[model samples]
Target: MSELKAKLFQDLSDAVVDMDEEKTVETSHRVIDEGIDAYEAIEKGLAHGMDRVGELFDQEEYFIPEVLICSDAMYAGVEVLKPHLKGDEQGEKKKVVIGVIEGDTHDIGKNLVKIMLETSGFDVFDLGRDIPPQQFVDKAKEVGAHIIGLSTLMTTTMDGMREVVRILEETNLREQFKVIVGGGPISQSFADKIGADGYAANAADAVRLARKLVS
Candidate 1:
């Protein structure tokens, strides 16, 4: 990367980490104006910042409110960059259907995962919070999605994730799409028991796992 492009990437990352939405948006526009690759801006800039935010959250250096604010900044940058993405940058993207499972209204993690996946070049179809298992199956079929990502912050709603896997199996679609699960109460062992293809501990891991599954 050139010195100017390097600086813009750094500025974009810092803007998000600082929770400066306006700066993030402005820098994103600068990225487009300078004819930088939108994909690079998103991966090296916004996603890089969100990765740090995740680390801070893990260390308790940042709490929920701070992470949420940082996410706002990151997403604002994404909005500005999305329209400028070139066709080659978007060609043949993998499709993913993501949602917070039924009886689970908490979606901060799910939203973060969606943003990161989109920025990382996945075709994300967000089914939103409190989605039924059948809805996930239906949407995945509709979109010809390669992966079905289920999330739940509650142990009570975790069963809903299993139901999605079960429904796919019964419909003989289990072989068609990979199923990945995540959230506060989810674990790899639980995922194995529930017959999910993978389990991600957080949003960043979710992106990595999705890539691995597809590749």
Candidate 2:
């Protein structure tokens, strides 16, 4: 039985990493047929595969397109398992606030981070793009979020992240949340300049940093 379970998990992980939607769906069904726990399949299979994909991304082995497709497969598997995840299981979620900073309309990076964070067990409050600094602060305060992920594809919008930090500092909320910055033009140096708690090169790194930040 352990071997069978391992095989199913391996198949599911491979399907997600391969970005094979049909294969992922089939494997999800196979796990169900085998009476395997859906949460185990998600945690041990798709989530594990996504972590590898993130590493590949960090190493420059995988690019944005590949990450997108792989995340799609993982989300598909999650959709299948969503129905079976228990109420108690659902309530243990950690909240994360995410959005693209002001003057930025690009959502590709933000969406990727959102998917990766959600897959890693964060309940993300996505504020969408073109969001002002105050909006981010408001949402984070309202949701009692521990992590605030800011995405910006334009250099022009990088200042928005700084503004967010400034606003938080003024309100005694600076220590209330960890600020994580990302997007096309952001770097660890930039994060340091702006006083951000963390910076990730891609979605997976964002999840890693966010987890550490929240913890």
| Winning candidate number (lDDT) | 1
Provide the overall lDDT of each model, using Cα atoms, as 2-decimal numbers.
Answer: 0.88, 0.87
lDDT of 1 by residue, 116-170 (tens): 6775668999989888899999999998999999988778888898899999999
Report the poorest 10 consecutive residues by lDDT, candidate 1. Answer: 100-109
Error of 1 at 179 (Å): 0.9
Q: List runs of model 2 lying over 4 Å from the truth.
A: 103-105
* Candidate 1: regions farther than 4 A off: 153-158
TM-score, per-candidate, Cα-based:
0.84, 0.89
Question: How do the residues 1-215 of candidate 2 rate in per-residue lDDT, one tens digit apiece?
Answer: 49999998888888888988888888888888888888899988888888778788888898889989998998898888778777787777788899987544557888888988987889999998889999999999998998899988788878999999999999999999999999888999999999999999877788879888777
lDDT assessment of candidate 2: 0.87
Instruction: Give the backbone clash total of model 1.
Output: 0
Best by TM-score: 2
